[model samples]
Target: MSSLNTNTNIKSEIDIRKKANYKTEGSDNIRTKKQKKYVLIDGHVYDFLKRSFDIIFAIMFLMIASPVMLVVAFLIKLEDGGPIVHARICIGKNNREYKMYKFRSMIPNADQMFQLFTPEQMERYKVGAKFDDDPRLTRVGKFIRRISIDELPQLFSVVRNDMSVIGPRPVIEREAAAYGENRNKLLSVKPGITGWWQVNGRSDCAYLSDEAKNLQLYYVDHRSMGLDIKILLKTFKVVFYGKGAR
Candidate 1:
């Protein structure tokens, strides 16, 4: 948070410098050079709508998928003989840590063997990245993950007010910590099970990078009810088409 404040101040300084430079050039440049403040234009109405949508949509899905979730839960136990659901902490709004739930998709000891993989593999696993041929995934896990049937359990989290239906994907706290200066803005909103990254091009958390600050910044700066609906509509396409699978 301290770093974010410092970075914000630095940007403010840079904007001031750019305005001064524009003055020496021409009057036409002045209008274009005005500093854009980060203000969420929609305010309380947007927040209310975002929450209402999360709750209404989550409840609706849970009702429709109750049978499928039950079947998937049973299949998980029969496949690997472990807990049917998996839960772990992810950084959310204001970078607060909260437990997120998903149907168990890997071996019970999946975390124990994670260190054996190279740096390339570490990101994917930590950020809930599951490969199509990932051996750690049980047979049932593959099917659920492919259709994102595995993520249905998170409706409970949305019900509990710990997550959003649309926003940036939740990341591990360490992953947030690794962001250094950019973490605060990213953490300002609740993490979602699906968001622009998934809809735009990303599939998993293991691929996070510090240089993605622009994308992260865009999310906070431009998030709106209309944009949220657009993202949600796009997410449906990703889920049905298995957009991120490899």
Candidate 2:
């Protein structure tokens, strides 16, 4: 009996040693992987700089556009009796939800009408599919959207840190859900009021069919302060000329 007890003790000690060795090796491997995981551009310093730029741009844009914003609000209400701006839930960085504001381009209660007309609406919306002569649009809304002024309200969102002036456009939660692996890259930056897709021509571009990959990959590989400025200038030209519009 004593011999058997000794044998059991030896086996238990061996098992404990094996487990300890495994844990040590496993922990070391985990540490090594963590060390190798981060890319240089995505390091802590780059993140801090990126955030600083976003904040600075947000503040200045809000200040500069304040007067224009008030004028837009007044015109919207003057043309028709409805809310000056529209707000909807938009997905942000990290799959977070925030209310996004835009100039109201559709009639009141259009949200309710959306379900009934979705299939029919697809035929109407072309070049990213829009009803060129949508009955729901008010006179002021038409003018506002033509010049892309309808998007000006989102400067407030940029200031609020709910959005960026230049990132990929925010997808709705439903859109985000369909993203799958794309969401990982898409949600890395805050959604922008204007983006690669916007400047490339929202009106001329295909929907998720053709343009999504161009915008998505461009955003992932080539995002920079200079790129954002370039896109803004391009947007100005597009809006001014009324080229490729809905």
Candidate 3:
């Protein structure tokens, strides 16, 4: 009788353990489903169309802007004989690192000029990695930045499939921390030369602020062809007015 009792006790303990394991698995499945709700799934058709548009836009713009690019290159060379393009290591789609090119807009070795920053400038840089009245900007750099001309070189990146014409602007690896939990979602799509945030408020929205994170996530969540066209149209207005340019 005692043996039967011991056997019954063991069976009860095993049943309890099985129930606990089942509950744990159920909770995990629930959490996984919740995460899936946030995952962006750009269908194959959308991807193809977006890529086609990016290529067409980049080729046409490069042709039209070739002369302007040459002139800008000459001015940059004349100013300091430094590299005409500045390549920044930025976080791209799927958290890959890529060199994002821009017209060199600062003095050569500008990345190593942190020691020259005032305490105030250092604080500003910590916030957004940029500030007005930057001491590092050359004269041509200042003009190009103000007119958004420095960004023109990113067209090549678009052609290379490293970027899109419209998407979230790529952030440096350090800046990716600003997106917090949504960082993966932000990197799910290729970064862009212009984006929802760029046309909305650009530099006026502090990079580390909640507003900037929300704007970037909103684009990731709601990206569509219509919305892309809308952003492209608004970009012209923003660039023309130099809104939020520094």
Candidate 4:
């Protein structure tokens, strides 16, 4: 009888221990969920402010840049009698695809011209989806891209809520694939016109490279109003100096 009692006590003790561990694990999971919820709530205010600023800034800048945009449009049309705006499908927040607009900075049907690239040019294009001296650029294309005037039309995208003023620059589908498992994280926030990557080194840091990936991920993880302001200031400097404009 005593042995049976002892066995019963051991069984009870084991049952108690199992319950304790289960409770601990359950509580841990609840805590993790709560923490994630808190982060989302905390970022809500920041997102609101950022969106407000994007609209105001884009609208104001668009008004100021209207004359320049008209001149660019005229020049592009006169140069080749082709479309003045280039619309590209880029991956945006939450893996949503959107059309991103830029002033036409390349000849008409430039995408079809890729097959004509020389081996060296093709290799360089594979590195960053850009050419150091692309033959596809029109005379005016070269000038506008050099000064980043080509990017002005993206203000319309910002106003449309398709992009942010300071975030990772939107990537084409092929470029987005390079993010691999981290693609969701990269697309967790809206892509930007000028970003940490733009101000850091632009084309010098190849989009396919690990350095570029880390820099872009760093921005996504650490973005805030202060960081946005710093990026904006640096962007002006970069534009004026034409740093890494290739």
Candidate 5:
């Protein structure tokens, strides 16, 4: 499970992905829907039905969560008078970059405060790309994070067509290099707010480790509308139980 070969073209890439899938799962487990969806067009497998579902799901979630988002926004602002939404460039389909949004769950200028962390904490942060006991989190931030409320702002990204409702979670641009040859395959489809790895273990899986990499790759290789629906249903239970959240 090292990086894929660098010389692979679009068809070859798809072939390699299919071959990888076959090795990972028995042929009997291979779903035709997954195979049909990845015939690349201009370096992407456009699934209009999935995009349509994303649009509909985004609209419905927005409609249902608008009032709750407003309340969360007001509380965030009231706590420290800081920006309610945090935006950062995240890599999306075909290596395109877009601003991904989330509620600001940390103090303003938290990046600057990273220097204050102890060396051990900084080492952990570098390894995992997240802090198990983050000191920058605001009081309201801690609460919102525990219940997974901080991600509601990303519904806007979904509506804006920057992400799908169910797919691989987008990664920051700096983190994209780690994918190496798999980068193109990873970016061949739209990134999502939730997906297989997320529903399976969320933050518990070490970033860039085999567990995380394999899960993400498995999702990309074996993706289908049916798989997406299954992941979505599992996501609800994960959310309700607050499973694997930081």
Candidate 6:
């Protein structure tokens, strides 16, 4: 009986040692992976060229779009005598926070009036991050939103270096939680005015939904100057066709 007990003790010690070794190896593997590095592009040249492109095109677009922006601004103020733009605080590259520029498509007190929505409307807004029949929209707001003219002002962000001309869409800070382990990867490059997710399906895929995160992260992983150009061209089509603006 003593021999059996000794054997059982020995077996227990062996099992414990095996588990300890396994845990050590597991931790080592994770540490090794964490130490390895990845990069978005091959060289500094790509980054420089991308930034140059953003700057040049941002200037051009702003010059050309300024008149339209002014007209829209006038219409917004004429409607309700409210603010003309909405500078939403959003997450940018390296987890930097910046105010993303957009033409105002809601009433000036829109953020303060959430409780005015019906529970059903609030739920719908939460699901899509925008309400199709949002009460905050002024008459001018509906037109601009439907045609996506509201986002034209984001050229200012590109010019200001807060965003890229083409990359992943900037996300609200709270939405960062949904990226999970990929948050660092997503924030490695400047967010864009247009991107893979926008060209594929804008608000059709609700913000932070699995589908939206997958599309955004896919762009982050496989981004290139060539891909950016493709997205820019495709974005024109999506915008002109009013494919998924709502």
The candidate maximizing TM-score is 4
User: Which scores greater on lDDT, model 3 or model 5?
Assistant: 3
- Candidate 2 TM-score, true structure as reference: 0.74
Query: On residues 51-143, what C-alpha lDDT tens digit does candidate 2 reach at each position?
Result: 676778777877898888889889888887899889999889888889998889888876666554556665654224565666677888888
lDDT of each: 0.78, 0.76, 0.90, 0.92, 0.83, 0.86
For every model shown, what is its TM-score relative to the native structure? 0.76, 0.74, 0.81, 0.83, 0.80, 0.81
Tens-digit lDDT string for candidate 6 (1-246): 999999999999999999999999999998777555223334466788999999999999889988989999999989888889988899999998999878898888788998889998887677656657888888898899888889888988898999998998888877886788999999999999889999996978787688888899999888878898899899999989988886
Q: Relative to the unseen true structure, what is the C-alpha lDDT of residue 147 in candidate 1, on a scale of 0 to 100?
A: 85
Name the top lDDT candidate: 4
Off by over 4 Å in 5: 1-46
TM-score of decoy 1: 0.76
Candidate 2: minimum summed lDDT over ten consecutive residues — where?
122-131
**Stretch of 10 with least lDDT, candidate 1:** 33-42
In model 5, which residue pairs have backbone atoms overlapping below 3 Å?
Answer: none
Task: List per-candidate RMSD values in Å.
Answer: 14.1, 7.7, 8.4, 5.4, 15.1, 10.5
Looking at model 6, report the run of 10 residues with the lowest lDDT sum: 34-43
Cα lDDT of model 3 by residue, 102-181, tens digit: 99999999989988899989988877846678999999999998889999999999999999999997889888977878
Q: Which stretches of candidate 1 lie over 4 Å from their true place?
A: 1-41, 115-130, 204-206, 210-214
CA error at residue 106 for candidate 5, angstroms: 0.5
Question: Which residue pairs collide in model 2, if any?
Answer: 125-129, 125-130, 126-129, 126-130
Sort the predicted structures by lDDT, highest score first. 4, 3, 6, 5, 1, 2
Expressed as tens digits, the lDDT of each residue in 43-139 for candidate 4 is 9989999999999999999999999999999999999899999999999999999999999989889989987788989987887856557999999
**Error of model 4, residue 157, in angstroms:** 0.8
Encode model 1's per-residue lDDT on 1-246: one tens digit a residue: 999999999999999999887776766455445422213334766888889989999999999999999999999999868999999988888767788999998888877866657776665665545566565677888888888888899899898888998877777877777667878978889877677776776554234643344555567788988788888898889888887743
